[model samples]
Target chain A: MAGAPNQASLVERLVFRGTRIAALVILVVLVAPMIVIVPLSLTSGTLLIYPLPGLSGRWYEEFFTERLWVQATWNSVLIAVPTTVLATTLGTFAALGLNRLRSRLVPAVAVFLITPLIVPVIIYAVSAFYFYSRLGIVGTYPGLIFGHTALAIPFVVVTVNATLKNFDANLLRAALVLGATPRQAFARVTLPLILPGVLSGGLFAFITSFDELILTLFVASPEQRTLPRQLWSGVQETINPTIAAAAVVLMLVSVLVMLLAEWLRRQGRRIQGKQ
Target chain B: MERADRRRELVGWLLVAPSLLFMAFFFAVPIGAFLLRSVDNTDLVGAMPRTMAEIGGWNGQDLPDESLFMALGEDFTALPDITAAASLGRRLNHNLTGYRSLVMRTFTGLRRHEGPLGREALIAIDKRWSDPAHWRVIQQERSWLTPLYLLASLDLERGPEGIRTIPPERRLFVDLLVRTAWISIAVTLLCLVLGFPLAYVMASSGPRLSSWMLVLVLLPFWTSLLVRTTAWIVLLQRNGLVNQVLERLGLIDAPLTLIYNRLGVYIAMTHVLLPFLVLPLYSVMKGVGGDLTRAAAGLGAPPSTVFRRVYLPQVMPGIIAGCSLVFVLALGYYITPALVGGPRDQMIAHFIAYFTSTSVNWGMAASLAGILLLMVVVLYAALARLVGLDRLKAR
Candidate 1:
């Protein structure tokens, strides 16, 4: 569109139109399944086919009342809460350290810090199974938390690290120069500036651990089953309407998390603007 | 002042120390320890210490001496329980087929020894022991470490002669690794094909339309992977909406096989990974100002020439970054393939899971993990060289 419009020949116009059509088709393919599934989830028919026999909240009610589903929801929260806390704390520190260290080794150190994200999670799941089995913690909440936290930290690190890139180090030094203690300067200046990053990063950590299935498959016992693991088993059993309802519930949770993250990101950009 | 500077840097180190230690212990070391299993012989060496010590002096040409047989008998008796013996048997079975039953039969035979457990007595319990191949397996795994697992991962084995490929029927991991790479490359290309234009559109559109498109992409990105996978399952089933719609449109009387196959995997994986490409490529395209293209057009370059010469080069980093991300992510993918794919569609990750869980074969799991890890690192190194690491981080 920004090119010399008058000089555009018929062939160029055709190519451009062709590309736009392709893009539209791909966009529909990308988003269509998500849209179609929501209505399917609301359909009362036991079958997952289209043209629902009726409309009802029966499946959603079953999702709430089901023993396995309820247990999984609780387990997901149990693991995700501690995972978010531990990851956000440790990851925030990693971000803060790497941001301020002013060392030549930062890139390599950062890479090491984020390798958990880089490596395929299957590797993590298998290794974690071996590691936790030895520690006698594999089936326990603490074990799943440990595994999820390790995996989730990289997400936090990447998110907070990106935010830290926008952070001005002079602000910290300014506070310090004004005779506030190092701790005081950090508490007053640095933490607030990066809180949005930390909160959003925590949301990412929560969703990551929340949606995680592979590690839970290898690490968690039936007693420790999480939402994704349950969905996996449910789908493995059959693609019943109840499974679709479960998926919708899971999707809604992630959507809420995403909106919250987007909000925090906007607030972060606002802070950046004020700076 | 230098002391204060030192103190400040020390604070940075202190801040970083906990996570580094945590990650090293929980992440790196565990992975290292598990991967070490690919070469570890603690199972063998620990199970038969007496036999390992006694067998050291025996010549490879003959069956080991009566003393070695007595030592093996003693080692079998010395095991903590039948399960320990069984575990040892399983490990030996990996080295050579049927060693599990042989070891188990010998362990039971030793328990009911009629007299002195000499070479003759052991041979009577299991006639196969008279053969030198079984003894060779013991001698091979006598060390603190062995390459049996790692070699097996590539479908090679250590014959007395040297390393050679296993029988074609037994050869699996090599093909598995290749298939994983193939599938990942296909998915990456698909993402690039589907995403490049969408990303271009998102970058060039008006703010309102652009944000809407961005939401469409980000919605899937933010949605649960399992949910999207489940959607595909519902939508692609034979009696599902896709087939029904196609039929209503008179496309086919019979519903085409869609789910639980390669086509389904590609469709689901491309949809899942497409955003990863589009988001990064979109940012890169947005950052690529139109001035250069406009200038090139004004200077009489054709649209195609201007796009190729001016626009494409500027967006190369984004393309490289996005493609590499999608490809790498696809390499170790498990869930979508496991659910939507046929047995043939399962990737190396599926086997990694299988070996870890189903067969309880840590050696195979670790070996496969090690090989998969090597592939990822090599691909990452090659791609990092292309666009550098920071562009990946920016994505």
Candidate 2:
């Protein structure tokens, strides 16, 4: 570690070390449960109780083979994919529009766009359940997709808008000044520059839709059940090792997504640095 | 505005049109309609039109005349069957207790009747209806809207006389709201206590170590909520690792009941929300110059005094933002409490979920949700005022 030229007294050094140790401990507390889950999922016994009897892949196998688990994963994918596409496109456009407008309504419009992030999702679930039930779409994919899209849009808007903050409008002007039409300039110049943000925002939307459980509980029927809903019922209904396996898989997917997002973010930084 | 500026505004509006429409349809309209369910009284007025018309003119002192009784009998007999009677009875029972069974039994008696109905015969069929209180309740339900649900949420009930609080034994929603508030407050304080040192360390560290620490913090944020919750269940259950470690070390003779209780809720929620606190605080602390504290220290001030005078005020916005974020999130938390909490530990969100999903009571659900929404709005407003909502959006 590098130190400042100004020397610190014994007390300052002690306080620094103490705070560092405390921070490490807190970090462990935050990360320990996730680390423990992987090994626990490998326990050969049916029960999730700690102190493994032996190690086996039986639960993972069951997760892959069981009709309910398999179908729930498929349902989650089906919902999350459309949610990603829809939320990303709408959020990107809204960010673009906000970037262009310097009106007094900008703050108000931004707040409105982001209210889903602040509102208790239970309210949305109740409201969506009522509306979808009336429309006779309660137990269907489109219903869950629409509800999830509403929840996911704010995340996309926040991310894409953050990226737009650093965006150079003059690049588009340059493209337009060089005989490019507005649409062509946007497609060639703006989209490529902001694609990393757009993709990262889509990843966020995907995760939000994928992990959402409360809304799914309200709006989804048995056939429309997603993975989180399945996990909820599994915990409520039984204490089996299968849930540990599913949880491990869920964490794995989340980690992978995080890595992808981080890479995209670093790439965004690298692109910005190059420019 | 200039022509070019007007064109720009038009383009902006065109771009944002779809999202606005989407919010209006799926968000504003539906939520507005659902909140209206709390005051909706169309079910009763539509089902018992003649009874509503006749009962409107009657005073609360005594039972209505024979004509009103005939109308009541006509409405009850005209109801399709037990289901319709039970439905209307349930609506009326929101205002008056025991009307559900009263309506059901009267409907049964009316089903078997083969002769002309009158006030005397109706009273003979079910004597409870002879009381003016039940008649008053029916009359109160004649309106197209009522305060029954909003009042019920506060553990108050509407009567023929007016609104009054329910018995202490039945008082629940207020307690749930209070409990939810305290639990959220507790979790927010705990996260701040545990997170401040970590965030400080991260903010003060070199770039490489800070980025690595950032990854550690972001790991849980990116992980699935259910996954983290399930991990808590495994670690805190009766025969879980924590218990086994303590027992093996001779710390206790028996395992403590940690999971499925208030303690479990605090631990899990604090863990889940700690990152929220650290991230915002770290970002703010990073923006603050360290020289302020050093300057204070160099000016013959002690370290504690320097921190108290210089450091604390600068991070105040971060504190407010992080607390509001964690506190507001904790208020509506459902999954953690439902999975790990006991019956008494359930928050208002659990009840909202129960009424919305299990019991299918939109009125009760919307009322509870309305109260929860009010809390969120207040906290969000405070957050915006204290930390600036624009800063929150950047995060």
Candidate 3:
């Protein structure tokens, strides 16, 4: 019996070793493409045929010098910023309201909030084009902004709702009993508690609108084209190193935003752990 | 106090009112209109009133009347300039190809018409118009509510006589739908297979390992989709690092067909969508306790039996949530697949885009879109039934 038990332990240890190595290998495989692209973007060659010819920043220079690329970057920022603000505000408020609602309605409200996610984007995008064209707002900024907000709102609802799940209702009662006004209680207690979730939701909203492609293509005119739209047309009509430079910039921005979101989530976890 | 509660409820509704209105107008109404367009007969008769009237009393057995020819001549002569003709041509081209240039030429030739419209005048303008078949098409489409485009969208079309399925050789859209579903399902499965273990590890690991793993997983989320897809192209191309490594390692004799194919599509899409799966799965798994598996093991059960009977049941909800989330997302995927996947691998979204952009067939595009929406709803409903979403989220 001792020998048998010892043999089983040895087998378990070997399995654990194999699984860990496999996990590491999988991580390397997944991360390699992203790592490779960063270096290739710095290549001097016009065509992106691997084993990069030489090192240069000409593509990055071209990206800055080019009029359309600059305009598209500016356009993406314009759309992403306002979209983030709008989606985050609406989504946070909705999440708070839903959290306060009788628990029975939570599932129903959740289903409603998730429609934009469930429906295929192509359908929504095409319909939006027709809908906007009929209203005569197809090529306008507000039109694209609202369109992006609709897409981003779902992310806000999901993220904020997740954060609110852990919230204690008694905290609100405690604050009220302490003679704090309703508004004051929420500002001092509720806001501080859910602030990380709100910020994470906001970051997701910004990245969503920033990275959005399909709907932007439908609604954005040449003058209002977003970064993804410009990159799309660039790929279709012509391939240039400038696109690689733009890709590099987009990669950096996305990574930075996600990193910030991860940091906030960690802080929230730590706070919860301490409690 | 009741009044105050009511007021607060009203404010809550007011806050969400704008978004709801936006979705109703831009999302719901347009889908309704798109479906309506499939059955819309206004344009067929609206464009050619005289021919419509001339063909009203005609039967399907015989050729159309001379009056119909005269109406065609009149309609062609009064047709708008090349731009309008091109737009009309684009609409008709959705039903049948080669009609765009024909319509444009006919419109251009009509600018030089000399006499009152007749058969001779029609023949003089375009010899192709003399065919009875061409006359029959004009007569058939004279109805205000012809179902040509809708039928063609479903691989069926109405001839002068009645509706017929498009020839097998000409069929593409149905195949496109199947391909879309296949790719979406494959991507969903791939995400689950790749993400399940990682999410499990994240849930089960120590803080240091989990945080490091989280950063690695989230790194791709920081980049734009177009950039990530382009990166895959660079890495998977024939002479790219992947192939080069394979070649040097004696894994193959020749550069393998990697990028610009279904394999590339799978690799790139799986990479992009893995995060969606992991985030949801990890969050759900974080709530599941590990003691159950150990408890089962200590009860005189084998490890495999313990995992099957105790562990898998608990993780089912996470798996379902992750699968549905990834599957629905994969269905709408456009940029990644379009850039990496070859022509045959194009999904339904690609055709929706093609019809919207290149073909300009709003009706057909909407019908295809309607089908996609219906598929998602059905799948979602089925998923909800299989594993209740609340149960999934709770786990």
Candidate 4:
């Protein structure tokens, strides 16, 4: 490393500088559009034009007061909360089972479980529409919950599985040998360690259900329109600044979810590192 | 000891059963059923059960015997209602045009006839039925399954001679399939161009800087696709921020047509999918130390050569994984293209949705979806072979 600065050629320096600058410029382009929405959402004007007529919170107020927005928010929460609970419980157990699995079919099982995430959402959405119809749950809250839980389960499985990679099976054995039952062993020894994973999985499931559109489009009735579904139709209209406010609101939820997930990931890593 | 090991294994299987069963019931069976609709032809065969059974014995050129004509009359006359006949005709219409009207008209014609039902009488009812071409479609579709939808999805059809391409005017799905792949490849390349340098910088940076850059990438990465699409509209619409800035800079006298066009689709999709490529590439690059590049430089290899020869191969798996992820995701894109793309720019997924919701044609939708699934599975198998699919886990 000693001769690095001295030995570097002009082409080398120029290329590095160019890449760094290009990277920064692209990051701006990647991130600038979302930041642009905060102002547009705050615009008092009717259109999404620059040189705002003036700064105002009317859009936010409209977003809060409007029935469509309010109803969609409620629907999103109702679906996502149940989806989170169901997906997290089912997926954590699936991961725990997978972690202990010694069968040659483990790879196939994992692949099958993760298929919901890998396959196109449109495929799943269309099929779910048909499947739900067969069950007569096409437009119901329970249908969306079940539909969303399928999509969300894979994320939970992946997260918990990752956390479980660092988990030691002997801990369960030790707890059992100390006169604890299997339930006690799992509760005291394994649960606390995988809490971050479970929470992050739930968070992922929530956001996944919350942000989903295509599936909701197929399975949801007009009465069951969720936040993303509402934004979907609103964006198509392009006549309302209220959509911008809604977009910003959704973006905030996304950012908060991401931060929490990141923190949980780090926490999982920290706990694993200590072990 | 053996019993205990078996018990533990059983416990593992039991724990996995609930999720496995749920996905099977919800996800796998439904998609499998939907895709199978491309070949499903029970309704058509069931509607003309007598005709289907009798037609199997007839030669292609000649009119069927008295039993065949009698069975045909019975099948058409036995119709419980017009809707069943119409629905059967609709199914057959997919195989040969004009079958719907033929079946509906003939159903009424048979209903009115009181005397003997023969081949001549049936032909008198619907003159078009005398032609063997119509009979050929029924003959081919007598089976429980037919390739009508699958053939049509590729813009081909079974004709008098055999399978042949449809007329040029009607050939659409082949182009749409090509367009889907073309757009996906273009987006993947666009992502690679933009993501490479960013990942490079992120990997080479200090811990704090790297994490910050990672957040910069992940925030948009994790944002709802619709939100990102909405953001793009807010920024790229005419008189929007982009055009406003350009106008202020005197770059153009009028606002460019940005949103609702091809350029807009590229920009927004590239933005949405760029992180898929970057995250994996960045993680791969982070694992890839700079020692080799430095060693190459120490040996007098130029930066370009060092990069191409030394560094690129090290991150090849990442490039493959990331690019495939972007390409695969891009192929199934519906909302982005629907929201941003002009009518001329719509992809295969658009038609899949059109057939499902708008046209109410499950056969067409299933066939289109089948084509899409094939494309995805082929790419998936490739990626799974080249770089283990497990390595491309969602972050």
Could you tell me the TM-score of candidate 4?
0.96
| DockQ scores for all predicted structures | 0.76, 0.70, 0.49, 0.78
Instruction: Report the number of the highest-DockQ candidate.
Output: 4
User: Global lDDT for candidate 1?
Assistant: 0.90
User: How many angstroms is residue A57 displaced in model 3 relative to the true structure, after the best TM-score fit?
Assistant: 4.9
Q: What is the TM-score of chain B alone in each candidate?
A: 0.96, 0.95, 0.85, 0.95
Residue pairs in collision within model 2: none
Local accuracy by lDDT, each model: 0.90, 0.89, 0.79, 0.89
Residue clash pairs of candidate 3: A254-B222, A255-B222, B41-B144, B41-B145, B151-B156
> What class would a CAPRI assessor give candidate 1's docking?
medium
Q: Which tens-of-lDDT digit does each residue in B330-353 have in candidate 2?
A: 999999999999999999999988
Q: Write the candidate numbers in order of decreasing lDDT.
A: 1, 4, 2, 3
User: Per-residue lDDT of B1-395 in model 3, one digit per residue for the tens?
Assistant: 98877777776666556656656666667768766776676765676677778776766445556777788778766666666667766656655676777677778877877777776776677786666655566666766676666677778887655777788999987787778889989999888877877787788789899888888887875677787887777778777788888888999999998867899999999998888888878887888787998887777676668768988888777788888878887887888888888988888888888988886777778778777778788888888787765556667
lDDT of 3 at A157: 86
For all predicted structures, in order, the TM-scores are: 0.96, 0.96, 0.86, 0.96
Residue lDDT tens for model 4, A64-145 = 9999999999999999999999999999999989987789999999999999877899988888887789899999999999
Q: With candidate 3 superimposed using the best TM-score fit, by how many Å does residue A88's alpha carbon deviate from the native?
A: 2.6
Give me the runs in candidate 4 sitting further than 4 Å from their true place: A1-8, B388-395
TM-score on B-chain, cand. 4: 0.95
Interface RMSD of each: 1.2, 1.5, 2.4, 1.1
lDDT of 4 by residue, B128-170 (tens): 8778878877888889988889999999998778899999998
Can you give the lDDT of residue B195 in candidate 4?
A: 95
